[model samples]
Target: MTTNPERTIPPTTAGERAMLESWLDFHRETLARKCVGLDDKRLREASAPPSALTLLGLVRHMAEVERHWFRRVLAGEQEAGRIYYDEADKDGDFRVSESDTWEEAHATWQAEIARARENAAGRSLDDLSAGGHRDIESFNLRWIYVHMIEEYARHNGHADLIRERIDGATGF
Candidate 1:
């Protein structure tokens, strides 16, 4: 089994925000580490029939997710359009095409991550969303951080299985 080096979250950390950010970063690297050494074709391969998931698709979907939560909702950019979703096809992020290369997907995901960090920087965990859509008016920065960490954790589990299936690699 091949081993990939991943960023480790400190077992014990100071402050809630620091701990949350550290774990989120670790999970982000974990997903990227899963895709390491895979070519575009391999990254685009699905685990089994009927599921449209792929490492490339997950990367794209995460990019869309980061943009939605950090930029659109938390930062109050309601006019911003989704990075991958479409009214006609809501699952465009997961429905990646042959034309979507791993390079593009990974780069977009990285960019979104950077933007999310920038948006959250200097803001308190107690900071609330500037605005939100109907019904849900606002959310605290802490909620966004926790939600993102949870999202990444769930998706990283999928990534683990997918990576293992791809190359028999396990335990990064």
Candidate 2:
């Protein structure tokens, strides 16, 4: 059965920034809802053979993504570093270990999301990122929001499939 009906629905019409943030928030809630009632082991369950994707891992990965775009790129904190991954094992976030508890991961992800909001607050959509990453130079808040929406939407799809596989739950 579905869960978490409290997710905010994006308005049919709204200002540009409001629309983007709303959609992003909706997708964020969708991902979290996919994991509802699932235990840590279940949350870490892979999709199938040869695929290590998990809901908890997705949460962690998104945490890293939020930190990178907001704090490191937009806020220009080069030394902020990564939360769950590094040079050797870029997919470490997805490599959910036994030590990684769902509660802790969720809290960390939420913290990153909050910081993302704080960093973007009072900033114009046209404002370029204080720094840039490999290949690209900089991205405006608009671009970051759009990219984050896309990222979450794509992962929510994966989350749907994984949640379905776990206990035949679907269409949350």
Candidate 3:
């Protein structure tokens, strides 16, 4: 299937909102563009031992990662369900059920990213919330930005290897 091109930064002066948006768009685009052309088998194929680092799994996991931080933590929405929380201890996102298809994984991820983009649209950098009164003192917004980059970077690394294993494709 044809994929949309990478998301671009909105033209603006260098500011905190722009920087946050750039990072968010960068990671989402990285995953979508990097996983292009992978077939169902390749998307679900396990990369190594212990855990399945399939591109499909990464997509699902990244969607959860985005929702966990953006909706649950930052927005203080306590009702958001954990991704695959219904599967007990097993990594259901990575397990790839008999009915699980590449299209399902891709659609789920894209929907989550779209939700996150909507969430980002209504906020500014200076708007601050302390998240909670627990021992952690960092700002809520900072955690959101950092976690997005960290989750994307880790899974994108998995995508790189998974792509290479699929057909010798490589690059960021």
Candidate 4:
């Protein structure tokens, strides 16, 4: 029943961006690993108290968050909305149905990650900051990479406990 300590970031160097991406990859892989062997019932099981922090909902939510930050914001598509965002009901990504399958959630998240990787493929940290006539906040490509990595790291922490509680499994 011991909890792992937080990650200690190493000092940055010439390939700092690459290093950040590596960390991001590790966290993403850890998150995916957390959901491994989980069936639909377990994926949707709300083990956390008073809230539905199911793996399926976390998958869907991360997909939307990735899309919102990378596709919409980074690509200068202000009109694009978060997945399932509406005035009628905000946070729709979290509100899962009983019939929601793990496969569908996994697919959606993978696609979103693919799109984000594509958007960042040819560009360096320098290109990400080159905002010309864009209304969204301009950030260095380095910042975007760091921020996203941070987001994943934070969410992965939550995922760790949620996954463990569902089946008593832990560790990356």
Candidate 5:
């Protein structure tokens, strides 16, 4: 299938939330672009040696992350279960299988991204989550956006290397 071209993130943007969301969306598109045109086998290929990081794994992980922060935390859904992974196998999302397909992963990721956007639609950056994970007692929407941007930025670096290793594709 022909993959869509990556959307450009404006170098200069107005407003704090716009800038944050734009960068986050750019990084999200970058990760998707990295996986574009690759089949399930290519998506599940592990990086060199000990790391189990794969393009598909990254997509799954991000879906969980988006859900966790937006739906669970921000929306105050403490009972929400994970889309991937469990207490028995916390890293299950990163553990690929022959049965796992790119279509499934991509669809889940897109759905979670949409849910996250919807959950944050009318919320203000100054709005705080009902609760926070672990040491963080509470978190504001602004913090979540910034954290997600950082998370994507770091993972996109890994994605860049893995994509190149897979097919010599480079640059965003």
Candidate 6:
């Protein structure tokens, strides 16, 4: 097992909000850590046939996810040009091109994360999203936090396998 030094485990004991934030941050760092030492070509390598999943793709997808949940849904703001995918190309973020660079993907994901934190700051956990997302309307901040944690946890598992496959690395 290869341990990534970037992430610190969430504290075992904390308040509700603090715990949620910590775990979410940990999972985010976990994903980034998984891709830490890879080249762009390796980051864009698919896991297997028929599945376009890649580390770079996951980073882009997470950037899209973070923007959607925080900026559009929670903050009730338009993300404008930075949106990574759309209905016309639903899998756009997951389809990494030769042009895609790890530098750009990492920066975008990190930027979205910073924006997510900014959008959530000063808001109570009970606060509702400023708008609806898909078939759902009005997600409380707490739910968004939990949902993000779950999303990252699930994707982090994929990242684990991908990283392992890429460079025989595991653990963070």
lDDT of 4 by residue, 1-172 (tens): 1233244344467376678777766666666777887788888888667987777777788888778767776676666567745668777887788898877887878788888787777777776543322365577667777778888878888888888898888886
The digit string of per-residue lDDT tens for model 6 on 25-116 reads 89998888888777889999998777889999999999999988999999988643455677798889999999999888888888989989
Which prediction has the highest TM-score against the true structure?
Answer: 2
Worst 10 residues of 3 by lDDT: 129-138
TM-scores for every candidate against the unseen true structure: 0.93, 0.96, 0.81, 0.82, 0.95, 0.93
CA error at residue 154 for candidate 2, angstroms: 0.6
lDDT winner, 3 or 6: 6
lDDT of 6 at 149: 95
Q: What range of 10 consecutive residues in model 2 has the weakest lDDT sum?
A: 1-10
| Candidate 1: worst-modelled 10 consecutive residues by lDDT | 1-10
Candidate 6: where is the Cα deviation over 4 Å?
Answer: 1-5, 79-82
Ranking by TM-score: 2, 5, 6, 1, 4, 3
Residue-wise C-alpha lDDT for candidate 2, range 1-172, written one tens digit per residue: 1256369799988999899989989988888889888888899899987999998999999999999999999999998899999999999999998778888998999999999999999999999999898989899999999999999999999999999999998987
lDDT of each: 0.88, 0.91, 0.70, 0.73, 0.88, 0.87
Candidate 4: TM-score? 0.82
Compare candidates 1 and 4 on lDDT and give the better one. 1
Can you tell me which runs of candidate 2 are displaced by over 4 Å? 1-5
How many clashing residue pairs, candidate 1? 0
The RMSD (Cα, Å) of candidate 6 is 2.3
User: Model 6: how far is 58 from its true place, Å?
Assistant: 0.3
Global CA lDDT of candidate 2, please? 0.91
- RMSD to truth, every model: 2.3, 1.8, 3.1, 5.3, 1.3, 2.3
| lDDT of candidate 3 over 18-116, digit per residue (tens) | 766787677788888777776777678878776667777778778777776666656656577776535475566556755667687777777777777
lDDT of 6 at 170: 85
Clashes of 6: 0
| Stretches of candidate 1 exceeding 4 Å from the true structure | 1-6
Give per-residue CA lDDT, model 5, range 68-143, as digits (tens): 9988888888887897799999999899999988889889989989999998888899999976888887899999
